[model samples]
Target chain A: MTPRARREALTGFLLILPWGLGFCAFTAGPMAISLVLSLTKWDILTAPHYVGLANFANLWHDPLFWMALRNTLAYTVLTVPLSLAGSLTLALLLNRRVPAVSVLRALFYLPELMPTVATAIIWTWLLNTHFGLLNYLLSRLGLPQVAWLESTTWALPSLVLMGLWTIGGNRMLIFLAGLQGIPEELHEAAALDGASRGRRLWHVTLPLLSPVIFFNFVLGVIASFQVFTPAYIVTNGGPADSTLVYVLYLYRNGFQYFQMGYAAAMAWVMLLLLLAFTWVQFRLMQRWVYYEGGATPG
Target chain B: MRSKWTSVLVMAALAGTMWTLGGGSPAQAQKVTTIRMVWQGEANELKLYQGLVSKFEQSHPDIRVNLETVVASSDPEYFQKVQVIAASGDYPDVIYGHYSWFPAALAKHFLLDIDPYLAKAGLAKSAYFPTAIQQFSDHGKLYALPRETSSIALYYNADMFKQAGLRTPNEYYAAGQWTWNTFLTVAKKLTRDSNGKSADQPGFNPNAIVQWGTVAPVNMPFGLFPVVYSFGGDVLDPTNTRCRLDRPAAVRGIAFLQDLLLKQHAGILPSQAQQTNLFANGKIGMMASGYWDIVVTGSAIKTFAWDVAPLPKGTIQSTRVATGAYAIPAKAPHPDQAWTLIRFLSQPDNTMELAHLGLIIPALRAAALSPEFLAPGKVPLHRKVFVDALAYGRLDPRTTHWAEMVDTLGSEMDLVWTGQKSPAAATGEACAKIDALLQH
Candidate 1:
């Protein structure tokens, strides 16, 4: 290589050196160690004992593992599409020219900015069966009270409902950005062809918004699978392990139960599952997701 | 490029110098040993601990105590932090943790065997309550020494009994008539609906209770185990290797609670917040909890007149006991100093101070029964009931996998609490789960 080219390359490498070093040291190094640790029998307080495939094998018989996985999948399946739809609906509404629209946007986004610990505590009271504001309102409307966090059947669904409160914030902002990026000419052309406003939205707007929905869908599903703080703080993964999401169970095994190796194995399995789901979503995305730049060959 | 490399080398050298300077000087490394202690407590309790540390440090001029408290939001978080600290191998010289925690910590060999220190200090197992010592020991090896011990007792709202024209629990105890049958009858009478109709009255609405008769042992095994034991059953078999929750006595005990909460409506099933301060809420006629509740109830109940009494006899009177103890890790840097601090903190005077503050019942028999501890202050008038209950108090079962077992049982028990399953079915399922876990 020429001297000038070598000098430029060396300078570029030096600039990124700190980030590269940090990634290798903190993230990659620990991930590699966790991979090795999953193959052993290690409580945090004791020396790790080599026990090939034992921790992974134990997961098959562990009823709690299966229960947690089922709860996590239920959460993901319920949350992702609903959150996407809710956020997109909010974004479409906000995308209109309205009085104090900026203020309204910030107001809607406020729940996401609040700390999760505080949010969970607030929801705990608001969901209380006898005394909570929600049930009080229902009673005022002449409806029967429903046990929320207290009932095993309702606990997971209650958490899903709690999660919807924040969808008007971050995901809606993304949807808003996606909506704004859609060309007005397409909608105008549809209208000129005598299409109804609803038809124009169905044909032009939704197609353009599909990519953003897909992105949010993938992220929402991933986030839902790792639900921890609400279950940890509010229900403690109970009324009967009904809200025992995957990450919370992993935490119980690793920290509360002191079975770090088993927790590592659970973590690895979660990562693989997430990867598999994301891959399937991406494959399906080819059929549904649309791009404006004509990037996809017909 | 050359200047940048030169500057990097200079920065590295300066960092090295700073690190070297940060190390203690050779002259500073003498016989004054610093013992690091990790503890968990609320503000007032920690202040008391800090004060005790200062006094201990004053007495032993050469020993310095350094406290590192982890303000645990919950038990699981506290255990997680302790395990992480233990894993780092930079263990504190001493740790103040729950009795339930020691079994799991001991199983993983995180805690040091305090037997040698106990021998050196000329202390015997008799120094503490038998249950306290037993709870902290595993396989005949002691890992910790009790700082305080607590046992459950019946606490009743005095005005509720008086207004209902019913005999008080302590009065019944004095008359030697405080059996479960009499207790239940009294409970039924005291329980009133919104229309002031007693539980036995026709058309009494269980759904709209104005006053609950009692608060059943709803959450902890500490609360439930005593009733089961009173009926001559236990959570685990005698070997502690298999669950005995499905035993007839346990089923009977649990079924009694289910009937109270779900059928008889003598007790209301409380929410999580209600459970914390249920006795003080004035809606319940009676509740059973640990001796530690005296402090909380004393402070919270301003309008109500309350007192404690022995838990009414079931098949036989029984209660579950628990303790908080100071343990040293296996690789602690200053074990001797840690032991000295543990010994000093557990002295009679210190224990009396703690008891006076309504923090604990001293584990030491003499201290527990001292005038300062027994004297009536702001709290329950019948504090002696706590000491009396100890005669029938049994320690919670401690297996190597205590946390896992408790969690499994707790989940199944929740089914019973929610009325989705019978006590027999829930306990049977719990036994199966626990049996599988123990075998694992």
Candidate 2:
């Protein structure tokens, strides 16, 4: 090889080395081991004996596994879009040249900065049926008190509400970046053509913001798929396992039941499902998600 | 500059590799062995344990005890984590485990058979409480050493009983009239609304009552087990290999508890957040708690007068005597040192001193009955009830999967208490699941 080509190749390898090593060690290693583990019947102690898809076969008939999956899918479907909309709405409101808009944005985003445990604790008190502030206010206004986390019907939604509280930061940041990226000339041209505010937003603002919206949607979907901590700490998958998310069940299997092999299988299944969902989202995005410059030819 | 950067990166990578590889080696070779001693206790109790460990280290210069204490809230999770570590063949020499955990640990062969050590130490089997010792033994092999034993009792608000013109629980216990029927009557009398109406009164709104007659933290399996037993129920068959909670008596026991909450409405069902605070604030009159609550809840009960008495009898009188024990792991690197620590902790004098501090009821009968440990000022007033109840206290049926059974039962019982399912239905469901679990 020529000296210049060798030098370029060496520099390229050096630049990529740290990330490449990290990817192999952290991500690839666990993925490969988990796949092997999924086929075994090991607790933490005994030697892992090959069971050959017995764990996956068990999941087919496991009622609790299906229930947990349904609950998780429901939570993700409800939370991701609702949170994205809430974030975008707040972002639009703050994008204007209002007084102290930055301060308002920061104030709105503060809940996301609080530790998850702290947020959960605060929400537990707020959502309590009898003694909670929410019920008290509702009663004062002559509205019926809702059992937020106690009733099986309300428990999952209560957790969804709690999860929504932290969306402000993510939404605000993404929206701000999207809004700044919108070309000023388009808005002025829309105004010159006597376009209404709604028209301008629908045509210019939304199309320009599609890339950021897609990015946030993908991130939100992935994060929402692994919703475990709130249900774990606050509800403990209870009032009859109504809030038992997929990851929470995986945790129970791995730690509580000492069924690590089963949990490993559940994890890989979850990864494949998420991967498929992301792929579908990307495929569907061809119709709506517009690039600023142009769509690349396939 | 390029050479310096490359060298730095290489050195960092090497250092990281070396750090990872070197970690597990030095931990094995440390001559002054650091034994991780873990237990669940209050802050003060932990402080006392630390002091005792320091004393222990002073006496044995060659060994060092690395005290690892966890709060009671995290005790179950910590126990599970430690068990996982034990399974991984890297367990501490000594561990503080609940009596219920002994069967599972022994089943897994994770606990060391300490009978030989006890025999060598000249510790007679008769020295400890018979029930406590029997609970730690499985199939003729003693797998653990009981550090303390506790019994469930009826803890009452003495001031409320007085105001309601009811006799103290001690008087009833003394008269052998502390039956479940009389207990229910007293609960109804003491259960009053803010408008000065008893549960029997015409205008009494159970939901709107400001003060409840009793509070049973229905979550604790040890507290609930006796009620089931008293009603002529058993959690498992004679061999403890099959579940029997679906039986008529067990269903009756569960139904009675649900009636106390839903039908009679004699107690408050606070939201999960309010349960602990409500009990501590004297909003509930009586709660069936363990002897350890004397340390946990007693310190918080300065608002009103509260004392414990023997739990009221059901069809057949019984109560649960739960204990926490010290066990050496089967993989313990220093078995001799672990035994020395267990022997020191289990000595009568040490047990008495510890009990006098109100940590728990000592497992040694002599230490428990000693005046220094049993005196009124040293231990709380309600503790005597636990002492009395020990005569009738029954050990939980030994099962290798007791923890899983408890989790299932506790959750199902919660459903019963919440009026979501009938006692019969919940108990039947739990039995089916438990039977499946046991088979596994």
Candidate 3:
């Protein structure tokens, strides 16, 4: 290589060195260690004893693991779509040409800015069984009291409801951005074509919104898979272990049980599951997700 | 470049100087030894400890102590954190931890055997409560020194009993009539709805009852197992190496408690708020709780009278005492200094003062029985019962996996209380899981 080219390459490598080293140290190191630890049996005190795939085999046979998996999947399925719908609806409402739209946007996004622990504490009081506003309103209407976090059946759904409260922050912002990016000429052209409001939305707006919807769906699913804090703080996987999400179980194994190796294995399994789901979503997105420009040449 | 090199040299020299000066001079170090002491407590409790450490420092000018406090939501989390610290080989010189924590700490060789130290310190094993000392021993080796002990007792609202035309629990106890059946009868009578109907009334609604006769905090297995033992079931065998939940006595005990919530509807399921509030409000006639509640509950009750009474007898006539001890870590950097701190903390005078603080029952039987400890006070009403109950109190079964056992069993117990599962079936499931855990 020429001297100038070599100098430029060296400078480029130096510039990228910090981030590359950080990725290896902070991310890749733990990930590799977790993969190895997953196949072993070790409580924090003792040295890890390699048991090959016994931990995975044990997980497969464990009823609680299956229950956690089912509960997590159910939570994700319920949360992602509902949060998407809520976010998109808010975004559409705030996309108007009304005065103080920015202020209204900020108001809707305020909850997202709150720390999760603080938000959880607020929601706990709000959803409390006897003295909560929800129950008080229900009682005023002559409805029976519902135990929000106390009942086995209602606990997971209550968390979903709590999670839905923060949906406006991310989803609304994404949808708002998507709304702005939609050119005014398309809607004007549709109007000139004598298209009705419904037809214009169906033909133009929704097609353009699909990309944002796809983005939120993937992000929401990944976030939902690792749901832990609500269950940890509020229900504690109880009234009857009804809300024992996968990440909560992993936390219990690692921190509470001191079974770091087993927890590592569970983490890798969760990663594999997420990877598979993402891949499946990519395959399925071909049929539904619409791009503003036609599909790029492969 | 010369100036930069000069700056680097100056910085290095300054760092070295600071290290030496801050580290301590060799002559001063011989006189002043820094000891790291670890414990878990509330902010107020930690403040008291800081005050005590300051006092100790002033009195013993040769020693400097650093206090490390962990505020854990529960005992299990506290034990887990300590274990991790121990495993990392960075254990503090002196640790204030639970008696249940000692077995695992011993198993991992993470604690010093303090028997020789106790002997050298002229401390008698007979001076401390036998059960408390027993809790810290493994195969005749002393691994920890008892700092404080707590036992479960039935705290009752005296006003609730009088309003219901029921005899107080102490009266029942004096008459030798405070059996589980009699306790249940009193609870049923005391439990009333806003409509002034007792739970025993024909039209009483379990879900609609406003005032409950008792509060059952299921999270405390130490409190729960007294009833289990009374029904002739034990948490484990004598060796503490096997699961005993499937025993018929244990099943019956659990069922009896479950029946109070489901069938009799006489007990309120205690929440975090209701735990301290319900008993103080005169709404709950009785509740099984530790001595820690004495101060909290006693201070809150103003309108009505309240007092502590011995727990009603089960088949075994037992209660459970939860104790904590001072332990020197095996990996302690300064073993001699750690031993000194442990001995200092466990001195009968020091322990008695701690007990007088009303936070815990003294582990020293002699101190616990002192006139000062038994003196009438806001706490003494409940403290007396705990002191008496200690004679019959059994220690919580210790296992390496006690935390997980509680998690699994506590969840299953919730199911039994909620009427989703029969006690027999729940116990069976818990037994199988606990057995599997034991094997592991």
Best by DockQ: 1
Ranking, TM-score, top scorer first? 1, 3, 2
Most accurate candidate by TM-score: 1
- Indicate the worst ten consecutive residues by lDDT in candidate 1 chain A: A289-298
Model 2 per-residue lDDT tens digits across residues B248-303: 99888878778877888786554542533666787777878787778777888777
Pairs of residues at least 3 apart in sequence or in different chains that clash in candidate 2: none
User: Of models 1 and 3, which has the larger TM-score?
Assistant: 1
- Model 1 off-target regions past 4 Å? A1-15, A296-298, B1-30, B138-141, B272-278
Which portions of model 3 miss their true places by more than 4 Å? Answer: A1-22, A295-298, B1-33, B58-63, B272-276, B379-382
Worst 10 residues of 3 chain B by lDDT: B270-279
Clashing residue pairs in candidate 1 (N, C-alpha, C atoms within 3 angstroms)? none
Q: In CAPRI terms, where does candidate 2 land?
A: acceptable
Query: Model 3, range B1-440, lDDT digits (tens) per residue?
Result: 99999999999999999999888855553567898988898766777778778877777777788998877887768877877776676768988988766666777777888888878878888887888888898888888888788888888888889888889888999999999889889888888876878987887766566677887535448657888877789887777777898888898888888888778978877763462375786678898888887776777878888888888887767888878888888778887888776666666677666776678878888888887888867543545778888888888887888778888898888788778999999989988898888888
Model 2 misses residue B316 by how many Å? 2.2
True C-alpha contacts between chains kept, each model in order: 0.74, 0.26, 0.69
TM-score of each: 0.92, 0.90, 0.91
Name the top lDDT candidate. Answer: 1
Docking model 3 quality class: medium
Ranked candidates, highest DockQ first = 1, 3, 2
